[model samples]
Target chain A: MIKTKIWVIVISLILTVSAALSVIIFTLPKKNVVAIYSDGELLREIDLSEVAEPYTFKVEHGDGFNEILVERGRIRVSFADCPDRCCVNYGWYYGGASPVVCIPHKLVIKAVNSQKDDFDVVTG
Target chain B: MKTKRIALDAVLTALALSVFIIEQQIPLPIPVPGVKLGLSNVVTLFALFAVSPLDALLILSLRIGIGNVFAGSVTGLIFSAAGGLLCYVTELILYKFLTDRQIWVCGVFGAIAHGVGQIFAAVGVSATAEIFIYLPVLILCGIVTGALTGSLAQVSVIKLKKVFPFLPFRRKKEEKQN
Candidate 1:
């Protein structure tokens, strides 16, 4: 009896929170910048909107590196030495609540606005 | 008694490993990080009831340890280990108050704990509390997936007990029933 009540309450609560999360994650505006992070440190941030020339750079980490290929308004880890290469599979960053997390190398590539970045307070 | 326990745990560990690996092959319908069906938890849930909580913990740890080797990532192991330990510990505690039919409750709570643990790891590793943004989403997925895996485990325990009446775990259940 109590267990059933617990299930009902827990499920309802999760559903409510999930709905809210999805709304927030999906509705985020396309950001103009993306910050690449390795082992909790901000490696670099590219202003996608300001990229006059598409370029590629190797982001070296302790374990390995991710070859980040950037274009005018998008970014992606086109190559990496990590075993899974799931980060490279992330393809391109448009806009979403979820970032491109490179699990093996502990790198996170996330979309953000130039006005406000998530990594700003890290070093401070 | 020790041999029986070892044999059963080995089998359960294998069951969980295959489930974990195969589930990975099936691409997720959604692109959410730290979100998956978590179907392998079904086996852990089954073992939690079919054996003892201690045995369940052992099997879960073994599965996570070996599963990560199959996953081929060092860091992935850390994440899964955090999530797996949290889920196992949460369900082990919840099992006491939970009736056999209320197994899904264990799942719901276990999944929340799993997500919360992984998020803490993510936040610490990424050195950004902003990663907390994924918490609500992972928890939301945890509830749905945990319930599904929990219900499967409940049905499994009932059917498994009947098939293996000599099972030490089933003997305990019968003793309680009588």
Candidate 2:
């Protein structure tokens, strides 16, 4: 019991430090992607590049997961019906590192980039 | 002790698998992606004390294998095996020093260990550190669920001694049954 308590305290401290360190290390702003979100009532868009006007996607809002295509420039989750709005987490539509994920609504906006044809991981 | 050990462990493993399958159907209020109560671990705790360590390992493997198959996710098999292996190893190590009264702590640690193992598997599958963001949440869930499962296992250990007194309590009865 004494040993177990000691182990717990030590492990707890180690876990805390690692978790905090990871958060600090990974919050860097990623620049090469665009993310989008909208309700049937409102549409919001952001672009990877600081341009005068980003390309617009066409779509109508309904009570389900909705996707709007940004063509060759960039892509975003046009809209979703679910509440958590995880589609926003999937930051952009063109990189291997980030896949736009919508956790609450179970919607995803996948980025299709023509530059790289090879994928490093196959999630089986 | 040798032959009876095999049979008892087999039964406990099957029981754990049944509990795992049943618990899968009862949805949780919070829809965190991979969290679970692990109620089936009660059978594991029982087998740990009542049977030999080798027998306990067999039960753990069987329970994990059967649970994954029943849940219909072959992808989950790696996580189940890794998590189960870590939990079983931790429980065995904890039992060496702690008494049955201290089983709750073992349960807590087992849960954390299981979460760590699962995350390791997830990192491989997801291929992104973004998935690691959920580790703390998973660990908290592990501690909570581990304590619950541990308490239930403790109660079952006590009750089984009374109901099946001869099976668990008596050396003579064990010999005769064997």
Choose the strongest candidate by TM-score.
1
- Candidate 1: residue A62 lDDT (0-100): 78
B122 in model 1: Cα distance from truth in Å? 1.7
Show model 2 residue runs off by greater than 4 Å.
A1-124, B1-3, B162-165, B168-178
Instruction: Report the C-alpha lDDT of model 2 over A1-124, residue by residue, as the tens digit.
Output: 3554665685567557655754653463333434343332224444443334555554444545555545444566655555765564444466443456555443444332322325754352
Question: What is the per-residue lDDT of model 1 for residues A12-108, given as tens digits with 9 covering 90 to 100?
Answer: 9778977798689778644477888888899888778778888998878776989988897778889999998988887887534568878778889
In order, the Cα lDDT scores of the candidates are 0.80, 0.64
lDDT of 1 by residue, B31-106 (tens): 5667878888898888887788888888888888999998999778888988889988899888876777778878
Question: What interface RMSD does each of the candidate structures achieve?
Answer: 3.9, 8.1
Cα lDDT tens digits for candidate 2, B1-178: 5566556666787788888889888888754456788777777777776555666787888888888988889778888887888888999888776555556667777887787788888888868666666677677677778877887876776567667755632211222110
Give the least accurate 10-residue stretch of model 1 chain A, judged by summed lDDT: A115-124
What is the TM-score of candidate 2? 0.61
